[model samples]
Target: MRDTMKPCQHTLSDDVVYKDVVVVGNGPSGMVTSFVLAGNVPYLKDIPEDLPIDEMLRARLSNLPPGQSLYDADLLELAEGLEGRSQNPISLLMDNLLRPCADLGIQADSLIEWRYDVEKEIDHVVLGRGPPGGAWHTFPPQVRTLSPGAWLSLPPHTTDSAERLTASAVAEYCRRYVQACHLQRYFRCNVVVTSVTAAPPGTGAPCSPACPRSASYCVSGYDHKEGRGFRYACRRVVIAAGACDRPNVLPEHISHHALHQLAALEKAAQLNQQHPKSQSRCWWWVRGVSAADAVRLARASGLHVYHLHRTAADSLAKLPLLNYPDYNQVYKMMCDGASGNYTNYKSLPEHMIVEVTPLLSPQTTNTEEENKIRLKKVKLLNLVTNKTVELTVYIVAVLIGSKPDLFFLQTNFDLNTIEIKKCKCNEKKIDEKQCFLRNHWHYLKSVLGQSIQSCKSRYLNYTEINGNIDTKCALPDCNKRDTCTCNTKAERGLAVRECKCEIIPYSNLRREKNCQCQPTNPYSSGLGYGIDPKKPVDGRSNPVAIDKSTHEMFNFPGMYALGPLTADNFIRFIPGGALALVTHIHREMKSE
Candidate 1:
């Protein structure tokens, strides 16, 4: 007799408010956005038929100046032509909810404070440190107006509004706490982070020192009134907080490799000249391939070679290339980039890893016969044992690294040895499991590292990243760390350990995880290897989540205003036949 399982227990609706707009970040963008939207809101429709009489009364009452009253204010409304709309229709009904509420009162004051310090420096020195005669603002502190002079001068996306989504359980002392007391009077609400780890350029922080909206904000945790923080809702949330608004930093050891890659990129860029998007045609995708393979591929006609993790995919995603990285379409051999002779981030055996050397060439350019051939790897020195270890070069290389979660090793274990686990494609000949583990592990450390398993487990956060792997993933449950599902045994010849939550190998990544603390993978959702990896995960659901799938801003309307259009990006970037190819591919996919 089969036992019946219980019915699905439904949950209650959270106390969460369905905001008309819940802007994630509270940086210059969020704040000024809220201010412009709320305080000086423009009317949605033209003049609202009722305005003429109101204007007339105000004009009659104010003989001296129509500007003195509300009617004198310039009417604000949607421009005659709003831009950046897609084929799919979206809501004409968006609720006007104010994000980053008024806890930012001192935010205005701190900006004023910082500005005063600079202006007074030269004058104070001229006076020999004597008390200044007057202050910078021509009027008294009480005079609040959006006139020629005001605190709302900074552009959005640059300064910190200081208010942010405080994840539950983890109290945020960085901004909210700073905004609490006397500190607000002296300092800005949210502090901006200026380093690569915190806020990178094109983020909340501008690279230029003299950027109109340049300033650092604070980031840290503190005690709250106990509980009460982030509430997980069914709808979507955003993460456009600020540059200083990052989750965590990578460990010092892992981060240096990215810096090395950046240095190489700089040199490469210099060698190719600034307009090298053309000559820099070598599409090197370093994932789980060997150095021999890398050299082989690099020497090939089209593609270049590099290692995963070392390439810095996620971090660089925040840069200009994410918009249209010509590298994406180049034949990419997807693999984890880990020198797994001995380390973590190893890909499993059962998972499909197609091996073949990939073809690479100047993207979007017609290739000549001379530019289309593959290369083979030559024997390389095995320094560890001084033996020759040969590696083969194949199409598109991927780095394979391992990230062993205690969550896995802790819960499901019956092992005493450092055994390599593998899935049997057939289980007829090769000792794939033991062979793989023995080839790429430090038995001593795996055993030794278990000394500290007593630490309390907080929560888990697995943010699903984007395909480009440039920007940070949206926080899953901000308060929690990342906890992934790891299967203990290989059931039916399939290794259950392999999942997106596992190690993410990328040609480039600013970071794979956020919190460096153990027992939890900080940025666990692993860098988005490609667009919505879930499509690869689940059989159903389209990979591309049409605009309606998300509540966040898709693209900027005035992108054309920022930079001049180049033929490479504006038109030629797409492979000549990609559009037709994409259509055909989509049709095939739908049929399948």
Candidate 2:
């Protein structure tokens, strides 16, 4: 069929060729959509002049593979070939093709760049300027697939026996999949979609008389090769732009002053290096900071910090500890240097400026003396205890977590329809005083309160320990208590005069047979302490709402989305979602 049909001349040129579909991404989702549409629909082989494009594209979609059972023997074969070899099936194929040369000690990496030239075979164009792998190409080399290698596989291609895959492998696999399936011919690489606007009235090819002036959509973008803008009018548009394409910015509520203060503290710390013996003391008040950011900033500043909220546990786990060596070092530093003491600060001074009161005359005080005197103490009120503790430190660093990166969505779409709202933790209205704190502090405080209550209950139970009961001894000063007895007879005689109970470490006491009270895991919660119990921590937020049946934008007809854009960013869910979306588009186009 491909050999018999001549390629559209307009597509070859810079001129606009009205297509049945124009997929606006080259990611897994975009590639799958193009493949499914081209492979299934036979009318794409020859667009009838009299028939409407949508109707022509959708015709006989039923004859194609069933949506639910799209995976078949051909796909299985591809999977088998790809299994246990390489993440990039194309790379694997190339390796196989060049194996004879490799046996003669030829270097494949030196022979060619690991990229395939895609042919523009299908009527529909898959537009992306990025590497054939899309967002996967930008992923860190050390990053591994959250889902198994098989889950990362696109349709008609499988990862085979491989259980896991790295980011590079996934990228290569995508490139290879495109080449192997001959889907590359459909791709228009090096074209970035700038905007998707409604087709201008009374322009382009007419699909029907009822909407003679209207085309469903016109995708306009810059072509890097041509160094000029290009537009394509299409009956359907699929937006497979991954979630991370546009970086999310921190929320407006976050205090710039606090960040400036942190920067100043960092500068001050750097200056204190000259006097190693008299190192300035730094205390990080981790109230609003995300666990990930806290660790990062703390490591950068060389400051001792602590997480005061259990909510940070989830964010902490999402940090790429394994992929980035710095994260591992920071994790170790946080564990060793900082205390994970969750404390509530209530009814405190809003902003107390503590500057060292100069004792010596201005003329007598030298620069070194002035620097020493500049380090002063700050008072913090403990909400639980209602006591003000003066912490003698040069600077206090406050870490507040970052907000979702929905800048692109907010700018492009309606926020209300998309359901972009303040975080669940950001319940209270921000005030001038509270602006310095994190939005999620209240939520973290509540979790801390629960932990504290649990700890108190354990402490109370320990104090009530009896001789008959297998109780953890809660005697605060067991050494001070002369009434304590030991199990050994040798220490029994000394029990009346001195406390004979062996002093076991607090952590070890939990598992000790004689210890009555067991301490709870300090970081225990739904997400666990210091790690993301959930695989993808950023789920449920910054979602691009889509109709499940069609995977289309609820408000925008002819516009579809998938992958992280639709709240299903995991590797496992992307392929299925891509399939369903394409199927829906096919059915919808067919109905037209």
lDDT of 2 by residue, 1-592 (tens): 2333334323312455576678877888787777666654211122234422223223432244443232221222222343222232222322222221332333221111122112212357899868677877765444455455544655544333334566788888888888887776789888856555565555355434113233467676667888876767776777776644422222222221123233334344455445563334444344222333333544444544333332223333454655444444434433432243322111122223222222223435455323432444455445445655565554334443221121111112211121111111111222443433434555754644322333333334221111112223333422232344422111211101123446443332232112222321111111110012221112244344556555676666777766655555554445545545555654443444
lDDT of 1 by residue, 99-203 (tens): 111222322221011111111110000000001111111112221221112222221112333222212101222234223322222222222211101111233
Candidate 2: regions farther than 4 A off: 1-15, 40-122, 160-163, 203-214, 251-312, 315-539
For model 2, state the Cα shift of residue 127 in Å. Answer: 2.3
Q: Rate the local accuracy (lDDT) of all candidates.
A: 0.22, 0.43
lDDT of 1: 0.22
Error of 2 at 70 (Å): 5.6
